[model samples]
Target: MIQLDQVTVRFRIPHERIPTFQEYAIRWLQRRGVRYSNFNALNNLSFSVDQGETVGVIGPNGAGKSTLLKVIAQVIRPTQGRVRLRGRVAPLLELGAGFDYEMTGRENVFLNGAVLGFSRRDMARRLDRIVDFSGIGDFIDAPVRTYSSGMVARLGFAVATDVQPEVLIIDEVLAVGDAHFQQKSAARIRKFRQSGSTILVVSHNPASIKALCNRVLWLERGVIRLVGPVEQVMQQYAPDAPSPFSK
Candidate 1:
């Protein structure tokens, strides 16, 4: 379960861009302070997810969809308000987010597993399954920098979902791989759902959201526009358009 109360995330943006450190140094020497403006990524947002609930978040670009996930995942603390979470959380936010570019794919799995509070022995037992699911083949021994974007995403997903966490958070990383891998990833998520895990997913793909989510939360300009049943929110968010999930 997850709950957020009046959560607000604010960021400071400089009015003028300092292209280089040299320019910033010169401006500092001249005693001219850079002006900054505050932007709220999330504005007093409050919501809750029940255990075993599958929720989808959808919005246009810069609408705080990603920031909401980061806040729930504890990657970003809200500037105001409070958040509560229950059980272990497995967050697949950015592709290759916890990986080291210099480390081999095999090594990075254990590294990320450790970050998730797994011991080396625990990861070792799960290593083969993770590698097999990733389908990295012999390339598992190669540096992550040598891998393709799809490979990196696959490896990350494999590690995060191999264990049965109480909560699963997924961002746009599902759009990374080919059709087959997408199917595999979806199946794994369904398995988690069947096991009574809570899920929060963000996707621009209408079909994906329709298929996976029981409820949808619509965010607009750092605020909650609506939150309700999937079809209800979908129709309200796009009234005139044909349903993207319709055959």
Candidate 2:
């Protein structure tokens, strides 16, 4: 199971800067301080998820849904609180930031696999399958700079999930892929759950949440507004518009 207890993220910024260290030290001695806004991204937020469960997270753009997912994925540390992740975690946070643009996609496969905690031999064993699943075979030997945003997302997701993490934390990167790959990715997620991996999905798309998640967590302004069955959460938070199929 995964547990987050009283997780809070605080950030600080300087209201002014001095060109020289001496000037900054003089200002500090004079009690001149910078103004700042403290934004508590996850305010004492806590949750738990059992294995094989799919938990969908929803909220406004800055409501900290992505922040909660990152806390679980260990991509970002909480300023105050604890996150207990019980297994191997794979996080799909950024589409192309993890890949080296100067390197071929094939090299990225190995590089990302290692970054994801896979051994060299393990990455080698999964490279072909990852390439095949990405559906970017023609460009696998090309530098990622040559691939479109969608293609990079596809390839990155494929590599991120190749090792079959015990806990999958998905952010909003799905927005970059095509519908076909979206469905394919959904199938892959189902397969992962079938193998007993827990999934925590963060997306605003209600259909995507309903299609893959069994439970849901809705956050607003860093607090969990709702947490329950997926259908119930959808009923509570669904936008007035429609899913892609509604058109």
For TM-score, the strongest prediction is 2
Model 1 lDDT at residue 203? 88
The number of the candidate with the highest lDDT is: 1
Question: How do the residues 217-244 of candidate 1 rate in per-residue lDDT, one tens digit apiece?
Answer: 9999899999999999988876655666
Clashing pairs in 1: none
TM-score per prediction, in order, is 0.88, 0.89
Candidate 2 residue lDDT tens string, 97-158: 46898999999988887777778898888888999999997889998889988898898888
Q: What TM-score should be assigned to candidate 2?
A: 0.89
After superposition, the stretches of candidate 1 with alpha carbons farther than 4 Å from their true spots are 18-33, 240-247
